[model samples]
Target chain A: MEIPVKTPSHSYAVTIGKGILREALTAQHDLFTKADKIIVLTDENVWTAQQSYFEANFPYIFEVHVMPAGEKCKSFENYNEVQTYLLKQKCTRKSLIIAFGGGAVGDLAGFVAATYMRGIPFIQMPTTILAHDSAVGGKTAINHELGKNMIGAFYQPEAVIFDITFLHSLSEKEVRSGMAEVIKHALISDAQWVEELLEGDHVTELPEDLLANYLAHGIQVKATIVEQDETEQSVRKYLNLGHTYGHAIEAAAGYGRVAHGEAVMIGLIFSLLLSEKFGKVNHQFTKRFLHFAMENGYPFEAVREFTFEQLTEYLLKDKKADYGQLQFVLLETIGQPFVQKVELEQCREIDRQLRALLAEV
Target chain B: MEIPVKTPSHSYAVTIGKGILREALTAQHDLFTKADKIIVLTDENVWTAQQSYFEANFPYIFEVHVMPAGEKCKSFENYNEVQTYLLKQKCTRKSLIIAFGGGAVGDLAGFVAATYMRGIPFIQMPTTILAHDSAVGGKTAINHELGKNMIGAFYQPEAVIFDITFLHSLSEKEVRSGMAEVIKHALISDAQWVEELLEGDHVTELPEDLLANYLAHGIQVKATIVEQDETEQSVRKYLNLGHTYGHAIEAAAGYGRVAHGEAVMIGLIFSLLLSEKFGKVNHQFTKRFLHFAMENGYPFEAVREFTFEQLTEYLLKDKKADYGQLQFVLLETIGQPFVQKVELEQCREIDRQLRALLAEV
Candidate 1:
């Protein structure tokens, strides 16, 4: 199935299916033909697991650069190395880049494509369920020693071709991480979807068809929000419902340890607790959501590893933090998100409440 | 005097006048008031010369980062260092950047602002005559080891404040290098302007008022082209009239050895020679332009420093080179520019002709 994403700068489609890599790429014949060279940027893990399948199915001749797996791929040093590789390969503005791993690979490759020769065309061929949220959006970046995604651009891809066959190699932890974004998408847009998910089977054990449906739904929710605000100047902030606090935990854990979605799941609960005070959300709903997260094995213990003061440093460094005050997207109701400014003192109070609730649950 | 630059992605004005820094910056009160913090990115040479003037006129408190002088500021190392500086300074998305130098500083700072935290608002305060062209067009970049400006973005500044008083510190070579772009603007847009320049006094010795007038005229020419083709997809290629061969020589001379416009001046002669063969341009006009350049001292000797075979490597690496064919922007007549694809064999012939003509002159 093809979903269209329209933004002010450029518009493209996101095609999702199982075993559709060859067909989706072939459909983009004109885009490929226009490129003088084709480069595939993936990681060691993805390339090792899917190289044979990819080579057999991909129609065009291309060069592949397998980078370090996980957050290491998003480092500034690796970013420079990929650029050097492109330069060595003589890739130009007319060249095309294929981001063929999970979120890390997509983010790094997308940023490289965005800055190479001012800008160039790239397509996201996301290999993990987590990429359903990242690959569809135009937020391309690499991590800084000081922060994650501290440098980047909102450069859109020519197209996003998500081939779920590549997801067969993913570990359960990866699946769990990917599902948190899917859940976040549901919470922000559809209370009915949230209710279904609350009563659904283990997130890691979802049937193939149901999983694809969820991924597409998540992409759609993200696409609609991105269409309204490409640069996160307004409505796009709604999509960051769990990220402000989530990134703090992820950063404190030295990245790749707690996993992005696991940290986000923890952050989702924090936002829920905050929402109970700032919005129409109820305490019973927040506790029920925490129970759902706990049952799904999202590693809430990671939150206990860092003191609120430890997280506070990373929290204030958030890109969304305006003038040293924390900005968060809170749910007025399950399906309605709004931006609110919270002071450190109030955030500390919420932190205390979250810790107490975690002890009770 | 303000010349408005309107591109599809962004629109701003180039406010040009002597000692207008105070008024121009004050007029942008709203932009300043919105920024949580302000940063000034400059080079040692520029800061050393104009820090007092800038500090006196600037109405806001801003942290300044003084980098190495010249093309050193555009190095990959410097780019990374600047990013680290901003992160260390605790700059957020609402922070503003001031690019307060010539082409290199502006290009580096602009690209920094374009990519830092996805992007942030920036203002261009040009400190030299050469920046009259670079600062207005929204072309921001940094040099890669493989090529010049191989990494960058098409990000426009909030406004360009051209305070002509800053030009007082430029050396004779700087003025000559800057005038070449002015001549290029005239060659590609106004026949009368070209005639006036050819008959006028040496470029470095122009009266202050006339120099400012030429800079404004050059900016106007650039602004119009940028408005039509912001991303260099079409008419904007015309602005690269002399850059193909110019970049080759500039790269061969190791970037800073021969200034940008000095190399462009040599490229202009090469393009005119090519135009004589491919367009309505005459051989006499090419030599006449060469004589004017000789009288103004544009360093044609840099062309002889490297063989045609040596320059060929950089030529094929040109961003304008399509599928290995050299793309040249030639004049049908003065004030009329068009794109043409030339083979390596034809380029070698033109190189020979340029050598013979230089020897004769």
Candidate 2:
């Protein structure tokens, strides 16, 4: 499946399918032909699991820079190290960077490409289901000591080549984590898509073809939203649907303690509650969504780990926070998402409602 | 005088005049009005020299961050400190950054603004004549250990406020350094402009109004080129007329030993010689230009400090370089420029010619 993404700055395609890595990469012969060198930036976990597969499929000669697995690779020190390596390698502006891991690797590599020699072309070769949404968006960043992805750029890639064959190695927890974003895409775009997902098999047990379809659908919704607002000036804020609260919990959990998508899944419930007050969303749907989440085991139990005040510390630090007020993406009904400014006092009330509801269930 | 810069990414004006800092800053009332907070990033030298004047004329409240003077402010450590400071101050994407210094400060602050929160609005308040070139172009960067400007972004500013009042504090060497780029702007765009500058008073002693006119003219030339090619893909390479050889020498001489514009002046002489060989430019004109540079005390003596072999390492690292061939921007004639690939053997021959010419003179 080839989904084209057109933004104000540039346009590229997200080519996604099972076992499509070699063919998809070959399709971008023009980008590779111009590259003076190709550097693959991946992580330890991905390299350990799929190095042979990647080596066999990727047709071009490239240098590989294996970084620490997970969020550790997104640190300032790691970012600088990668830059120093590029400088040492004499990577020119035409040197292409292959972001060949999950969201963390893509963010770090994309940002590396964005700033190296003031900017260079890079291709996103996402290896995880979670990257379906992130790989298509031009948002690339590294974590600051103060916040996650506080330092980055809206640097688009030359292309995103997704080979779902890599998904075979993802643990069950990783699948559950990745599916939260897929569910997010459904909630924000189509009511029918949301119903289908809600009634589907457990996230980890999804049939292979159905999983690919869901991932493609998610990328299309993200691409459409990104095309309309590449820099998040307006409708792009809708994509932040659960990230504001999600990032807060993820941050409050001390980063890596809770996976990103799991926190976002919990934040999704919080938005549904707020949507009930601000939009046409009803409590019944919100409850049904919560029950589905409980069945799939999204780790909402992490919510009980920190108080609202602890989470509030991270919330106010959100990029979307305006002079301390919270900005949230909430649903009007099942699909339509909108930005709404919510007060801290009201947020606390929602926290109470979420805990009570979680306790009852 | 207002010179507007229109790049594909953004459009803003360069407001240049004597003692016009306050008025120029105020003219962009919409920018300030939208900013939640204003943080001025300047070096100690600029803040100490112009703080009272800046404070008195400035129409708004702002936090000032005085960094160590010169290129030190553009280090990775300083970049991190600035991000931490902004985070501690509770700044958001709505906050504005004011880059108030020479090229180093502008590069650092512009890059800080470019990466902070994935980017924020920034205005250039350049305090030196050299900035007349750096301020208009949105090529923001910081120095990496291995190379100058290896880490950066092509982030355009909201506006540029050029107050000639700040130039009064510049040293004679600084003025000489700044005029090299002004001379370059003339060399690459208009033959008449080059003749005007060559026949004018010594760089440090030019009449105030005339200097301002020259600076404005230089900015206009830059704006025209940037409007055509914002990212230096084609016509913008013309602006790099003296930079390739200049940067190598600047690097070989250990950066601060040779001022940027002075090195560029020497590089301009080198290009003229290359132009005589490759283009229609006459040797007599090259000699005349070399005479003008020597008379202005542009430090042609610095050329004999390093051998061609010593500078070769940095030359190959040039961002415009492809594979291993050196890419140079040479004039077809004064005011007409094009890029050419020069082999190492040819480069060595030119280096010998430049040395022998510098020796005989």
Candidate 3:
């Protein structure tokens, strides 16, 4: 399956299939023939798992910078290291960057490409399930010591290779972690995907062949919203449905305590309760959504531990805030979310309600 | 005088007049109102000089970050510090960064604004003669540990505030340093300015008003080129006339030993020699150009010290190189400079002739 994202500078094709890595990379060579130098940014694990395959298949004498795996490496230090390496390598504007791993590698490599010589072309070869969400959106950045993705740009890639063969090596936990974003797509826009997740085991235990189906479906939903409002101006804020509370949870817990997807799972549950309070969605819709999210390995303790005050502070610091107000993405039903302009007072009320709910739990 | 640089995003007015600082800032309240927060990125010197004046003139509260003043501060460490300050101040997507100093402050702050939140709007409040060149161009970046401006982006400003009152505080050396760029503008494009320079007194200082007139003219020339090709796709490469050898001189002599303008002056002399060798321009044209440049306080030692091989290596590493070939900006006449695609052997021949010329001097 081919998914293309159209932007002002260029158009990108997201090729979804098994063993498309070699072909997808070959396609990139065709697009950037003038560029002979390639920089492949991938984690140690990914390099260990598949570096040789890429080295053999790639039609150029490229350098692969094997970064330490884990989200912690997505720091300013790492970004500087990559910049130093590129500078030392004598990489020019015509050189290309290949983000040949999961979301972390993608974000790190993509940002390096974005700021290197103003901007350069990079391709996304997403390996993990979590990358389905990350690989599609043009949001590329490294995390600051203070916050996650505090420094980044909405720079799109030249192409995205969603190779399911890479997903075959992912652990069960990694697969579950990636499903959080996929579930997020279903909750925000894909009503049919929600039904499919509830009926089938797509979200629970994603099969390799079903990987393309789920990845394409998730990307399509996110891309459609991103296409209409690329800069998160209006409708695109709906994609932050789980992220508002989820990011707070991730930050407060000191990142890597809970996976991004797990925190998002809890965020979705909290958002559901807020939806019910706002009369946007009923109890039945909330129950069904929570059931699907929880059964797919989301922890209940996530919501119980973090106080509402902590979450509120995190949301307040969110880049999405407009004029000091906390912006909320609430659902009208199970599958339709909208951005709500809520004042500080109303946000405090939501925080109070969340704490009360946690006390009851 | 109002100089406008019309870009795809917005039309910025670069005002050049006496005591325009307070008026220029106060007039921009509408733009500030759209921002979630406002930060004035100024050096310690600028803060001491004009921060109080700005605070008194502006109605709303705006944070002023006093950075260490100098070319040394244009590094990733300072860039991070600015990011930290912006984050701590609760800056959001709507935040506006006001760079209120010279070229270093403008480049560092503008780059910070560009990279922060993908990009935020920034206004340029230039306080030096050198900034006439830096202010109009959208190029914003910080120096990497390894190289000058190794990391950055092509981010334009919301407006440019060029208050001539600021020039009253500038030293004679600073004034002469900036005059080199104006001379470059004339050498590259304007025939009339070349005639004016030739007619002017050798070793004679420019009157305050005439300096402003020269800067305004220089800015207009650069602004037109930038407007045609913002990313230096073609015509904007003309602006790099002296920069090819200038960068080499700066790097070899250990930056700050020679002023940027002084180095550019030497580069200009070498360029003329190269032009004469390439049959691009006559000896009379070269001599006249050289005379006017020397009259303006351009240093001769920059060209005297380095071997041709050293300069060639630096040129090879230049951002303007295409497919291993160094592009030299050679003069056609007194006011006509064109980019010449020169190979390494051509570089050797020019260097041999330049050495002979320098020996005679």
DockQ of candidate 3 (2 decimals): 0.65
| TM-score result, candidate 3 | 0.94
Checking candidate 3 for backbone clashes, the offending pairs are none
On lDDT, the candidate that comes out on top is 1
Query: What's the i-RMS for candidate 3 in angstroms?
Result: 1.4
lDDT of 1 by residue, A1-361 (tens): 8999999999999999998889999999999899899999999999999999999999998999999998899999999999999999988889999999899999999999999999999999999988999998799999888888999999999999998888999899999999999999999999999999999999999999999999999999999999999999999999999999999999999888998999999999999999999999999999899998888999999889989999999999999999888999999999999999999999999999999998988
- Candidate 1 vs candidate 3: the lDDT winner is 1
Candidate 3, B1-361: lDDT as tens digits: 8888876544687877777777877788789788767888999887777766666666666788889988766978889998998888888889888898888999999888878878888999888888888878888888886778778888889889888777666776677777788888988887777888778865237777787788889989988888788887788888888888888888888887887877788778778878887646777777776766666667775776877777766777788876566888877776676788887887777767766765664
Q: After superposition, how far is residue A143 of candidate 2 from its true place, in Å?
A: 0.8
Q: What proportion of the real contacts between chains A and B does each prediction keep?
A: 0.83, 0.86, 0.62
Per-residue lDDT tens digits for candidate 1, residues B1-361, read 8999999999999999998989999889999999999999999989989989888888899999999988889998999999999999999999999999999999999999999999999999998888998999899999988888999999999999999999999999999999889999999999999999989999999998999899999999999999999999999999998999999999988878999999999999999999998999999999899999998888998988999999999899999877767899999999999999999999999999999999998
Better candidate number, 2 or 3, judged by DockQ? 2
Which of candidates 2 and 3 reaches a greater TM-score?
2
lDDT tens digits by residue: candidate 2, B210-324: 9999999999999999999999899999999889999989989987889999989989998998998899999889888999988998888888888899999878888889887
Candidate 1 backbone overlaps, count: 0
Off by over 4 Å in 2: none
How well is each residue in A1-361 modelled by candidate 2, as lDDT tens digits? 9999999999999999999998999999988988989999999999999999999998998999999998899999999999999988888888999999999999999999999999999999988888887888899999987788989999999999999999999988888888999999999999999999999899989999999999999999999999999998999888877888888888888877788889899999999999999999999999999999999988989999999989988888889887777899999988899889999999999999999999988
> What lDDT is reached at residue B271 by model 2?
93
lDDT of 1 at A226: 96
